[model samples]
Target: MQLIKLCDFRQPFSLNDVGCGYGALLAFLAKRHRGAKVDYLGTDLSQAMIDQAKPSPRPSMRSQFVVTGDIPRVADYSVASGIFNVKLNQPTVRWTLFIQQTLAGMHAASRLGFAVNFLAPPGPDMQAIPELYRVSPDVWASHCERQFGAKVELIEGYGMREFTLLVRR
Candidate 1:
C-alpha cells in the first residue's frame, strides 16, 4: 500500500509492474482504488508467474500479463515491489550493478515516476545474510538523482524491514 501511495491516483493512469508475480498487486490496486481507472501491465521473467496472473474483470480497469525479460512499454507510473531483496548468491557489487541497470530501465519506462523497495541492512542485533541484497536508501537515491536527474524521495519508517525510493521525472 505504501508503494502504491507514491503514485498519483486522482486520475486515470497506466502502470507497469516490473517483476510482478501472480498479479496480486494489480488486483489489490484495482480493489483499493475503486474510482481510479487503471491500465495494468505486469511483466515477469517466469512464464509460470505470467500464467498464474489472472486478468482483472473490473470494468474500470484493463490488464495484460506478459513473460518478458524487460518492461514492454511506458506507463504513467511504475512500481517494483520486493524485486531487489534476493541476490541469489551473486556478489554484492554485481547485485548493485544489476539494481542500477534495472532502475535506469524503470526510469526510462515511466512517464511520471517509479518506486522500488530495498531490504535495509540489518541492525547491530541482526546478522547479515549473503544471499539477500540489503541496501541503504541513500545509495540509490543519490544514483537516481545523479543518473536520471530525478527528484528522488526516500520513503522509510513505515514499520517495514525495507524502504522505498520514489523517483519522479
Candidate 2:
C-alpha cells in the first residue's frame, strides 16, 4: 500500500501486470482500487494460467486481461508482481533477450513506476525452487538500470523477496 501511494497509483490508474500467471496481484489490486475505477489488466503467455486464476469477489472485481500479444507500449504503472524470473529452455542469449524485451515492455508502458519481484533462490539445503529465474535483486536491478537508464531503488525482504523499480518518467 505504501509503495502504491508512494508511486501515486491511486484509483483510476492503469496497471499492466506482465506474465500474470495466476492474477493474484491483479485481483488484490482490483479489490484495493474498488473505491475508484482503476483499469487492472493482466497479460500472460499462458492461457492455462489465466484460466486457473482465482476469480475476484464480484464480476467487477475481476481484472481485465488478454492472452499474450501486443500489449501497452507505455502505461501509468507496470507491475510484475511475481514474474520476470521464469526459467526457459532457450539459450543464454535468448534468456537475456527475453528478460530485456519484457522489461522493455514495462518501460514503454509505465509512466510513473514499474514493480517486480524475484524471490531469492533457495539454498542448497532447500527442497525445491519452483520459480524459473532466481537471480538476486541487485543483479536484476543492474541489468534493468543498464538497459532502461532508470534510477533503481531496491527494496527487498518486505514480503518474500520483492523488487520494485521506481522508473524515471
Candidate 3:
C-alpha cells in the first residue's frame, strides 16, 4: 500500500495489480481505504493463484481476478510488488529483458502512473543471493524516464533493504 501512495485515493480510481498473488492488495485496500471507491483488477501468471483470489460465494462487481501475464485493461494506476525479486536460475540478460518488458506493459496499461518495488543491493553484512535479482533504483528509474518520459521518484528507507519506484506520467 505504501508503494502505491503516489495514486490519489481522494477520488475514485481504478487499479491493476500485476503479478497479484491471492489478491492481497485488494484485501489491503478493503481494510485501509474502505471509504475510497476502487475498481480493482488482479492478474497473475498462475491460474492457481487467480482461483484462490476469486471470492468464495460470489465475485464483487468492483474486483476481478485473471490469470495472465499482461494487463487486460487500462487502469488509473498499476502496481507490481515483489515481482522483480526472484529470478531463480534465469540469466541476468533474460531477467533484465523481462523486467523491462513488464515495466513497459505497466506503463501502457496505466493512465495516471504506476509503482513497483525491487530488492536493493545487499549490504556489506548481508550476503548476496544468486537467485534474487537485486540492483540500485537508478537502473529502473533511468529506464522509465528514458523510455516512457515518466517523472520517477525513488522511495527508500522504509526499514526494508528494498526500494519502490513511483513512476508518474
What is candidate 1's CA lDDT for residue 133? Answer: 86
- Could you tell me which 10 consecutive residues in candidate 2 have the lowest summed lDDT? 1-10
CA deviation > 4 Å runs, candidate 2: 1-7, 52-63, 121-131, 159-164
Best-performing candidate as measured by TM-score = 1
Question: 1-169, model 1: which lDDT tens digit per residue?
Answer: 6778767778889999999999999889778877778999999999999889988878888899999979999999988999899888888888888888899899999999999999998988999888888878899989999999999888898998889988999
Give the 10-residue window scoring lowest on summed lDDT in candidate 3. Answer: 54-63
Full-model lDDT for every candidate: 0.89, 0.65, 0.89
TM-score for candidate 2, residues paired by index: 0.74
Tens digits of lDDT, candidate 3, 46-140: 99888889542223228889999889999999999999999999999999999999999999999999999999999999998999999998999
Q: Order the numbered candidates by TM-score, best leading.
A: 1, 3, 2
Regions more than 4 Å wrong, model 1: none
lDDT of 1: 0.89
lDDT of 1 at 123: 87
lDDT for each residue of candidate 2 in 99-165, tens digit (9 for 90 to 100): 7787787788888767666657666776655436666667777877787778777775566544555
Error of 3 at 125 (Å): 0.4
